[model samples]
Target: MRTTPTAHPNTELLVYGIREIVDVANKIKGLDPALELTWENIGDPVAKGWSVPQFLKEILTEEIHRADNRSFAYTHSRGNIETRKWAVTYAKQFCPSSTLDYEDILFTNGLGSGIAMLYQMVAPGKRILQPSPTYPTHASFESFCSGNAPIFYKLDPEKGWAPDIADIEAQLQNHPDIVGITVINPNNPTGTIYSQETLEAITRLAEKYNVMIISDEIYFRMVFPGHTHVHMAELAHARVPLIVLRGLSKDIPWPGGRCGWLEFHNTDLDPAFKDYCEAVKKRVLLEVCASTLPQMVIPTVYNHPQFNAWNQQYSTELQTVADSIADTLNQIPELTVNKTLGAFYLMPRFKQGSLNNRQTLPITNPQVKAYIEQAVATPNLADDKRFTYYILANTGIVCVPASDFFSPYPGFRLTTLSRNPEERKKTYERFAEATKAYLGSG
Candidate 1:
């Protein structure tokens, strides 16, 4: 009984690449206070100089001082019933083809919590087929639950990061244990929006395989001028179950809020799916409820007269930044840059064989250089990660390696959330220079 306790094998599968790279940058900063770190690793808009809208802040302020004190109370396990009812009405525009009910909306601390719980609830030996270059949270949790590496269907960068239908179908055919397929529209890392045709094709495949569809639509409202976000619920067949995950964290630009919810679509089509939804609810019951104040302000925030204008303005600004960054990165012949259509990220990939372990960026600080050299020297270190550390030490720009997203390609993901135009211009130039130098060294 007193024998040494060991961590679960599943625990080793969990990795949040964004935060990990930040840790590396922090250590480098410690070694060199003059490093002047530019944080491009994480997707926190507020940290990147985005201000919360005054109207939304005023709504939260009003909710906080309500005489009823409802904001402080624990809501129903599923979430605030009235807020869920309002959500049902609001979500209908995106999922016009699917039937939705108030009872179907289940709120969580954030989508991160819900994503982890969803995978954890899966029966052993079953897997959710995730997209390659996935948001790390989904990949890590799904991998942990399966007790192995996650199964991935490629998102073809050559095709604007659209899901490869043939690859997906092949994976489903090869692995009968895949219980569902997850889609991130206006996808992370690669910010391309899925076309309606691509989504419909995936839906048809899911229908053919009888696998549920999990759509992460956190950035659905953040689409740029030319792109459209097609909700999976709209394309999924009636007999195929769907779970649409939405949250206030991204579009609302409120990472501190930590509020998100899941909408169960087509649950009525299958008793097992209904039971799975119930299991998710039961798990939430153990936690009482998500934050009550954020849930309370959902309707007020959405109904505000200035909300749509604010979101549109933000999207336009994001498109501008994406274009600027992509333009800079594209100039480097060693990289492939895709202009982001939605979301606040740009993933510039290295050309095949462009990055090798021998490549490096010159670091002036002796301490920082040694730290980065040792980090990169770790056995079996991915080339993208090695490049990430070198860039961090050389230019103080922190980006998560695309390989950390389980991408087949070697590259890195950086956020386009910086609000300062001059600062962004300088950062992009420095990043491009560093990338060129790194690749040339090889």
Candidate 2:
């Protein structure tokens, strides 16, 4: 039994990287049953007590009752015909001059898959650019598929996490290997919506470099007051090759649907790009198709009269929640909260030099304390991780560290989705208490 371990013969080249977001989420999920998990890690709305609107739910119910919808069947690998047409029409309603055809649209399990397929066609060593403090799935997928980590430009924290246009231009000028740019509007973790000027400037840069624009607009309908979600297709550039990814996951609050689509804007611009899309469609066709039930319901739910009203009321309420949480966190001098323009996340930055290795939240249980100590010993420990581990051990609160969000800062991302008013207040109060304790000890 003392023999040396044998090495595996082979593995997929793409399996080298890890998705820290989901890995950490699984660890939090496996916590002791006695603990109350606050679940501020994942961006799932239904998990936070936001229900699907009655009108949308009715469509699902009707679909279930219909005999024709029962079988699990294959669709066009490109997606259902009706859904693709509806999505095109949906885009045109916003971008009247936008040039996209049904052939350009491709459906996958979700945007996660769509991204992988898109990156697959890109030649190795050619990088896709994104911003720092990014969603791990985007950056990680690019790395996995292309065998290169993403080429990223800086998003200035002092400037409210906006992408530095000059840095972007400089990067593209210096690095001619970059073939595409990724933009996440109403970004995850930070919730900083890209300004219209920023969007246009990015488009111009993409055009200047002759690279495509990969815009992730999944939060398209989750906009709050004073901020609007602008689709890249709607930009005045009707000929800039762009791949816009979107779905019903966020707005409809139906993440389990396993349905999302990619709209290829300006596919005609590059013949090679057109061929790349065709290759992806061929790969998709091999899978029979994406989930059909969701595809079938897309036109129905989107065209319903109630969708707009529900989104307006829902976003208005979400704005209040985002504001309250930001204001509360800002009151704590130890934490700096950002303006959450659209999504339900607020990232509180821990003041520099405020945390130390020895700082901890008050913990009573010996077992939990031991676990926290082990988790905190890892390399590149940030102040946010210190605060997060302490809070988890002491208050039974589970949150994703900003380190997981790919930021150098030491702070955690807190959600504004605690639906119960009194319970929500208690959660914030406990967080503030834990933060104060950690900072005080330091």
Candidate 3:
């Protein structure tokens, strides 16, 4: 008798069960057939009414007209030599003390690809420390690579989502397998920027523990007036090896560019760390190299005078939306909105015990209500179940639950990228109303 074909399986890697913000956005996109879909769920600034500067467009157009770039060609897995040189120069401006070379820069499809490749190079079961309620890519990549959950050092919500250094040290003490620590400056989901004091303290921890430091500085240039960007390399913990990730995705507002690079700092300090980085480089060679067109545009975009003006204007307009959002949400006694320092997302926490299974948003449709009922019955009855669906069914607005962002509290996250100011205010007002109605506060 012929045996049935069996499905083959092997060990799971470090990435598992971690949901992405894009997945959430995609789900919403599928749901709304006719709605305007004020998209705050993802971090694509271009979609938020910010257009590329004219100089950048001209540069990109000129590159597109070049016949030499039309063919598929390969560069060193480390990246193009010229782009690498510029990266070194750009990084040197921030990290003046450290001498960085072109060899220090490794480019990839984007920061996401860079992160995945970097984590994959580490030995199996070796952990990379990450912040909780983090940019899910970091947590998901590490978890996917290790075939186990990535160890998370909590970013305290009460402390404005700042990294808890003491907690990190304690985790490192217990989990000796942790080989590195990662921080997202101008952090995703929560827009808090780390103070120089916090950055220095983290550097000290890395030095003490002899662990590698991986700083994702994708939002380095997105800081508003009160908040300033700080590069991890600038901290210059010489004893601690550093791998700094930066990209054009956020700063240049070019998500489609699919370009970013990692700069090695203190590579000379550890032979083992150097070897791991080499493995990542070899993998990049396997994939050829990052998109050359986007790499070519970097020098022009960063050099253009209009770049700073566009950034400043964008930040100012976003701050206004953030403030409006904060003021609107504050009217509701059941929920609390934190100060948004950077990034495009706002995380609002619902008062503890304020949300229970018994309370729910008023849904007119029986099918939607039944769907939500089944969704909440599972072991996970977090804020997403109530708030996310409530916003969907009642107000026809959708948002991700804060718990989806790995938060322990009962809360939800919303975006301030609505181009229409009046509609934006109305959305938040409706959010406040829906939240109150759900909690029976009215």
Candidate closest to the true structure, highest lDDT:
1
lDDT of each: 0.89, 0.77, 0.77
**TM-score for all predictions?**
0.98, 0.92, 0.91
Candidate 3 deviant stretches above 4 angstroms: 1-36, 70-74
lDDT tens per residue, model 3, 1-442: 9999774332343322223434533454455444344445666668777776777788888877878874146666677788889888888788888777888788889988999889878987789998888777788677777777668888887888889989999999999999899988888878889988988888898888888999988878878787788878878646689998889886667898898899888888889888987788777777767777777778778978888888888887778888888888888887777878886778888887777767777656565567556756767566555567656666666667776666666677776677678888788788788878888832
lDDT of 2 by residue, 1-442 (tens): 5988875332222331123434443454456446676766667778888888899879988987897754267777688887898888888988888767887888888888777777776777788887777777777677766665567787777877888899889889888888888888878768888888889999888877888888888888889877777778887345578888888687777889878898888877888777767777777776678888899888988889998888888888888777877777788897788878887777778788777787877656566666677778887677676677777767767777777666777777866777666777788888787778778885
Give the Å shift of residue 359 in candidate 3. Answer: 1.8
- Please say which candidate is ahead in TM-score: 1 or 2: 1
Clashes of 2: 1
Of the candidates numbered 1 and 3, which has the greater TM-score value?
1
- Report the lDDT tens digits of candidate 1 across residue range 326-385: 898899998998889999988889888898889887889999888888888899999999
Better candidate by lDDT, 1 or 3: 1
Off by over 4 Å in 1: none
Ranking by TM-score: 1, 2, 3
Per-prediction CA RMSD (Å): 1.2, 3.3, 2.9
